[model samples]
Target: MLKTLSAYIGEYKKVSIKTPIYIIVEVLMEILIPFVTASIIDKGIQAGDMSKVLMYGGLMLVLAFISLFAGIQAGKYSALASTGFACNLREGIYSNIQNFAFSNIDKYSTAGLITRMTTDVTNVQNAYQMILRIAVRAPLMMICSMVMCFIINPTLSFIFLGALILLGFVLFFIIYKVTPIFTEGFAKYDDLNASVQENVTGIRVVKAFVREDHENKKFSKAAGNLYKIFVKAESWLAFNNPIMMFVIYGSIIALSWFAAHFITDGTMTTGNLTSMFCYVMSMMMSLMMLSMIFVMVSMSVASARRIAEVLNEKADITNPENPVMEVPDGRIDFNHVNFTYKKDSDKDALEDIDIHINAGETIGIIGGTGCGKSSFVNLISRLYDVKDGSVCVGGIDVRDYDLETLRNEVSVVLQKNVLFSGTILDNLRWGDENASEEDCIEACRQACADEFIERMPDKYNTWIEQGGSNVSGGQRQRLCIARALLKHPKVLILDDSTSAVDTATDAKIKKAFATKIPGTTKIIVSQRISSIQDADRILVLENGCVSGFDTHENLVENNKVYREIYEVQTQGGGDFDEAGE
Candidate 1:
C-alpha cells in the first residue's frame, strides 16, 4: 500500500523532503535553549558576572528566532507537499477508474468510490502532513531532551524513563482499541454517501410518489449508523488526555521532590534542577504530540488501504500486446459464447449464444426483462468478454484488436441515455470531437433530432443542463441518438434507446437509419414489435438462451415465444414480459 501511494507523490517529492529537513533543524534549535539556560543560571547569575548572563541570554534569543523560522518553513513546505500529494491521488484514482472495464467497475459502488476519493483522501492527507512535521519533530525532540537529561545527571533521568514506560503502554492500549472502530466507521461513511446519492439523483421520483418522509427516515438511518460508530471510537480516545495529564504531573512531582533533597545534600545544584525541569516539560510535550500522531496514523491506515485498493486494481480487460489495429467491417460472429457478469456465479447471463451478423445488415433483438438483450449486444462491442468461446468482429477475435479501435468502430447508445452539462454542439462533439457544425447537423437530421434543435431559439448552441434534465425524455433520447450517429461507426447498437419517443417519431428515426446510413450494421433492442418487424431478421431470447433467430414472417409461424409476443402486441396491447408469462 505504501509503495502504491508513494508513486503519486510525483512532483512534490522535493517539498516533502524539505519539510522533514526543516523540522530537524527546528528541533535542534529548540533543544539548545534549555542547555543555554543552565549556563545562565550556574556560570553567570550565581557567579555575579552580568556579561556572561547577557551573552547567554542573547544567544538563547538567536536560537529561539532560528527555531521559529525553521518551524514556519516546515509548515509551509508540509502544506504544499500534502495538498499536492492529495491532488495527485485524486487524479490517479479518477484516471484509473476511467480505464476500468465493465466488470472492474461492478466491484465498487459509485458512492464507495466517491467516499474513497473524498473523505478517505482528506484523512490520509492530514495524516501525511502531521507525519512530515509533528511525527518527525516529536520523537527527535523527545530523544534529544532525554540525552541532555542523562548527560546532566544519570540518576535523575530514571524518573523520566519510568514515566515513559507507563505512558507508552497507555497510548498503545488506546490505539489498539480504536483502530478497528475507525476502519468500520469509514465503511459506514460509504453507506451514508450512497443514501444521499440515491436520494438526490431520484428526488423527482421520491416527490412524485409522496415518499419524502420515507426518504428522510432512510437518510437518518444511514447517518445515525455513521454517528454511532464515530461516537464509540471517540469514547475510547477520550482516555488519551486524562492518561497523559496523570503521567506528566506525576513525573513532575517526583522530579521536584527528589531534586529538592539532592540540592540540600549539595549533590545537584539549583541550576541543574531548573534545566531538568525544562527538559522534563519538553519530553512530556513531545510524548503528547506522539500520542496524537498515533491516533491520526491509526485512522489514516484504514484510509490508505482503501486508496491503495483503487490504485492497485488492474483492469480485467486490456488490449493485446500485438493488437489488430483496425476493424475490417461491421460483420460480427458470436461462436458458442457463454458469459456471466460475475466470475463466481452459478449461471451465465448469456448462455451458448451462437449467432452471426453480416456487414450492413439490420438486426432486431426482442426479449423480456433479464433476458440478455442488452447483454448480447454488449458483447458485440466487447463491452464484456465471453466466458467461453470467442466473439469475432469482421472474422477476427475481438480480444485481438486494440480496445480503442474496436470500441470506436462499434458505438452503443445505451437504454439509459446520459447527457453532460454543455451546449448541444458540445454534447454532440463527444461522438466526434473534431466534427464540424455541418457534420453535427447531418447526424441530428438522420436521428430526427434536428426538428427539436431547429425549434429551440439557440439551435445547436443551446446550453443543456446536467443529465439533460431541462429536456423532455423523448428529446433527450433523440439528442443521444444524434450523438451516436455522429460516430459513423461500422456497427451501431441501440438498447431500447427509442422507448421514450412516440411511435411516429420512433418509426421516423428507424426510417432515417434505413435511408441515411444503409451501409452501417444496426442492431436494435426493443420490447415493441413495431420497432423490429421491418428488420432483416429478429432474435428472440428466453432467459439467457436464444429461442429463435429469423425473419418476422418465419418467427410468427414457427417460434412459440416470438409468435406469442407478436400476437399480444398487435391484438391485445400487452408487453413482451406479459406475453412470455
Candidate 2:
C-alpha cells in the first residue's frame, strides 16, 4: 500500500524531503536553548559576572529566533507537499476509474467511490502532513532532550525513563482499542454517503411519493450508526490526555524531590536541576505529540487502504498489443456467445447466442422483460466481453481490435442516455469533438431534434441542465440520438432510445436512417411492433435464447413469442410501453 501510494507523490518529493530537514534543524536549535540558559544561571548569575549573563542571554534569544524561522519554513513545506499529494492522489484515482471496464466498476458502489475520493483522501492528507512534521520533530526532540537530561543528572533521569515507559503502555492500549472501531466507522461513512446521494438524486421522486419522513428516518439511522461508533472510539482515546498529564506531573515531582537531596549534597548544582526541569518538559511534550500522531495515523490507515484499492485496481478490459486498428465494416458475428455480468454467477445474461448480421442490413430486436435485449447489443461494442466464444466485428474478434477504434465504429445510444452540464452544442460535440457547427445541425435534423433546437430561445446555444433535466424526456432522447448520429459510425445500436418520442417522430427517425445513411447497419431494440414490422429482419429473444430471426411477416405466422406480441399491440390487448421490461 505504501509503495502504491508513494507513486502519486511526484514533483512534491522535493518539498517532502525539505520539510523533514527543516524540522530536524528546528528540533536541534530548540534543544540548545536550555543548555545556554543553564550557563547564564550557574556561571554568570551565581558568579556575579554581568558580561557572561548578557552574552549567553543574547545568544539564547538569537537561537530562539532561528528555531522559529526553521519551524515556519517546515510548516510551509509540509503544507505544499501534503496539498500537492492530495491533488495528485485525486487525479490518479479519477483517471484510473475512467479506464475501468464495466465489470470492474460493478465491484464498487458509487457512494463507496465517492467516499474514497473525498473523506478518505482528506484523512490521508492530514496524516501525511503530521508524519512529515510532528512525527519527525517529536522523536528527535525526545531523544536529544533525554540525552541532555542524562548528562545533567543521571540519578534523576531515571524518573523520565520510567514515565516514558508508563506513557508508552497507556498510549499503546488506547491506539489498539480505537483502531478497529475507527476502521469500522469509516465504512459506515460509505453507507451514510450512499444514503445522501440517493436521496438528493431522487429527491423529486421521494417528495412525489410523500416519503420525506421515511427518508429522514433512514438517513438518521445511518448517521446514528456512525455517531455511535465514533463515540465508542473517542471514549477509549479520552484516557490518553489524563494518563499523560498524570505521568508528566508525577515524574516532575519525583525528579524535584530526588534532585533537591543531590543539590544539598553538592552532587548536583541548582543550574543543572533547572536544566533537567526544562528537559523533562521537552521529552514529555514530545511523547504527547507522538500520541497525537498515533491517533491520526490510526484514523488514516483505513483511508489509506481504501485509496490503495482504487489505485491498484487493474482495468478488466484493455486493448491488446498489435491490435487491429480499424473495423472494416459493421458486419457483426456472434458465435456461441455467452456472457454473465458476474464471473461466479450461475445465470448468463446472454447465452449460446449465434447470429450473423450483414453490413447495411437493418435488424430489429424485440424481446420481453429480462430477454437480454440490451445485453445482446452491448456485446457488439465490447462493453462487456463474452464469457465464452467469440464476438467478431468485421471478421476480427473484438479482443483483437483496438478498443477505441472498435467503440468509435460501434456507436450506442443506451436506454438511459445521459447529457452533461453544458450548452446543447457542447453536449452534441461529445459525439465528435471537432465536428463543425453545420455538421452538428445536420445530425440534429436527421434525429428530428432540430425542430426543438430552433424553437428554444437560445437554439443550439441554450444551456442544458445536468442530466438534461431542463428538457422533456422526448427532447433528451432526440438530443442523444443526434449526438450519436454525429459519430457517423459503421454500426448504430439504439437500445430503446426512442421510447419517449411519439410514434410520428420515431417513424421519422427510422425514415432518416433508411434514406440518409443507407449503408450503415442499424440495430433497433424497441418494444413497439410497428417500429420493427418493416425491418429487413426481426430477432425474437426469449429466456436467453433466440426464438426466431426472420422477416416480420414470417415471424407473425411462425414464431409464437413474436406472434403474441404483435397481436397484443395490434389487437388493443396492450401497447409498446406496457410490454417493456
Candidate 3:
C-alpha cells in the first residue's frame, strides 16, 4: 500500500516539500498541547502564580492558533495534491485506453470500461487523499504522544503501552476481516454499474418490451446487496471507535488508581500527579487518531491495488523501435494473411487469403455474419496483428509505419458509430482537429448530412449530446462519414456503416464517395447486395473463408450464397441501381 502511495505521489507535480512541513508543524502543535495543560496544573495552580498561568496558557493559545493555521494549510496542500493526482491519473488512463488496439478493447465490454473510468478512479482518488493527509499525520502523532508520556511517568506510560498494543491487536483483526469485504464491494459495484449502464442505453428497447418492472427488480437486487455490504462494513468500522474510546478511558481510570499510592507515600508530588493525568488525556486523543487512520488506510490499500492493475498493463500493440515512416501510396497488398483472435488456437479468423488493391480503386467485401468481414479490414489498419502474413499499406508493411501516421492515413467508420459530447462541427473535427469551417461543411455536403444539419437550430454549431443520443441513427452515420471525409485519408473503410441510412440515402452517399473522393482507396463491407452491387470488385465470404472474388455480376452468377442474397433483397421491392455506362 505504501509503495502504491509513493508511486501516486510521484505522478503529481503539486506534491512539494511544503506538504511535509505543514504535517510536522501540525504534529508538533499536537505534542505541545498536553504539556501546556500539565504546566497550567503543576506550576500555576500549585504555586498560586496567576502570571505564570497566563504566560503558559498564552503560549498554548499561540500554539493552538498556529495548529489551526497549519491545519488549513495542510488541507490546501492535500486538496491540491489529490486533485492534480486524480486528473493525471484520469488522463494517463484515458491515453492508455485511447491507444489500446481495437482487439484489446473488444476483450473488455464497453460497460465494464465505463465502470473502470468513473467508479474505479473515484476509489483511487479517495485513497490518494487519505494517504497524503491522515496516513502521514496519525502515526506520527501516536509515536510523539507515547514518547511524551514516557518522559512524564515511565510506570504509567508502561500501562499506556500495553493498552495501545491491545488496541493494535483489535485493529489488525478488524482490518484483516474487512479487506476481503471491501474487495467484494468493488466487484458488486462493477456489476451494478454495468447493469445500470446497459439498461439506460437500451431503455428504448426495454420500454418497447415493457421490461421496466423486471429491470427495476433486477436493479433493486443489486442495489440491495450493495446496501447490505455497505451497512456491514460501516457497522464494523463504527464499532471500533466506541471500543477504542472505552479502552482509553479505562486505561486512565486504572492509571489513576495506581498513582494514588505514590502520591500518598510522598514519592510523587501533586504537580507530578497532575502531569500524569495530562499524559493520560494525550494518549486517548492519539489513540483516537490511530483508530481512524487504521480504518482508512485499510480501505485505501484495496483501492490502490485495483488502480495498479490498470496502470501496469502492457500494451500488445506498440510501434517497433526505428520504425519506418512510410507515406501511403494507396497500394495495399495482403500476402497469405492468416489471423486468429485466440493465442493458441488452430482455427484462423482469416485463412491463407491473398489479395492486392491498387491505388484509386473500390473494393467490396460481402460475407455472412461472423465471416471475418470486419476482422479483414481491421488488420489493414493494424488494429490486430496477422500471424501468417503481412498487410502492406502504401507498398510497405502496415507495422513499418508509425501508428499515428498510418491511422491518420486510414479512416474507418465502424459498424457502431460513435459521436462525442460536443457540437456537430466539433465532433466532425475529430477527423482533422485543425479542420476549417468550410472543410466541415464540404464533408457534410458530400456525406449527405448537410440537409438535416442545416435544419438544426444551430446548424454546424448544434450541440450533440454524448453518444449522439440526440441525433437519429441515420444522422449519426452521416456525421461519422463526414468526420472521415474531413480527414482526406488515403484509404477509407465503410464497414456496414450505411445500415442505418435508407437505400436512397445510401445511393447518394455512394455517388458522393465516387465523385467527391476521387483518389481515395475504398473498402465497402456490407451484408446488403444493393450497398456493394456497383463496386469494381466484390469478395464473397462463407464461414470465414473467401468463397470467390470478382465483379457483382460474376459473383451472383457463380456464388450460390451471393445469388440467393441478391434474389431475396432485390425481390423484396428494394430497387437496386446497378446501371453501368
What candidate 1 gets wrong by more than 4 Å, as runs, is 578-581
TM-score between model 3 and native: 0.92
Q: Clashing residue pairs in candidate 3, if any?
A: none
Candidate 3 Cα deviation (angstroms), residue 337: 1.4
> How close to the true structure is residue 25 of candidate 1, measured as C-alpha lDDT?
93
- TM-scores for every candidate against the unseen true structure: 0.98, 0.98, 0.92
1-581, model 1: which lDDT tens digit per residue?
99999999999999999999999999999999989998999999999999999999999999999999999999999999999999999999999999999889999999999999999999999999999999999999999999999998899899999899999999999999999999999999999999999999998999999999999999999999999999999999999999899989999999999899899999988889888999999999999999999999999999999999999999999999999999999998999999999889999998999999999999999988899998898888888889999999899999999999998899999988999999999999999999999999999988889998999999999999999989999999888988998889999999898887889999999999999989899999988999899999999998999999999999999999999999988898866653321
Instruction: Tell me the alpha-carbon RMSD of every candidate.
Output: 1.6, 1.3, 3.5
CA lDDT scores, all candidates in order: 0.93, 0.93, 0.80
In model 2, state the lDDT of residue 182. 91
lDDT, candidate 3, 1-581, per-residue tens: 34543565564545635566788898889678777877787789888999989999999999999988988888888788877777766666677778777667766666656655677667766666766776667677777877877776677788888888888888888888777787777667777887798899899899999999999999999899988987888878877978788887888788789889877887766766666676666667766766776666666566666556556655678998877776557777989999998778878999977988888788898877778888889998898999888999989998888898888888999988999999998999999999999999999999999999989989999999999999999999999999998888899999888887899999998899899886999899877788888988988876677788899999889988788778877787542222210
lDDT of 3 at 489: 89
After superposition, the stretches of candidate 2 with alpha carbons farther than 4 Å from their true spots are: 576-581
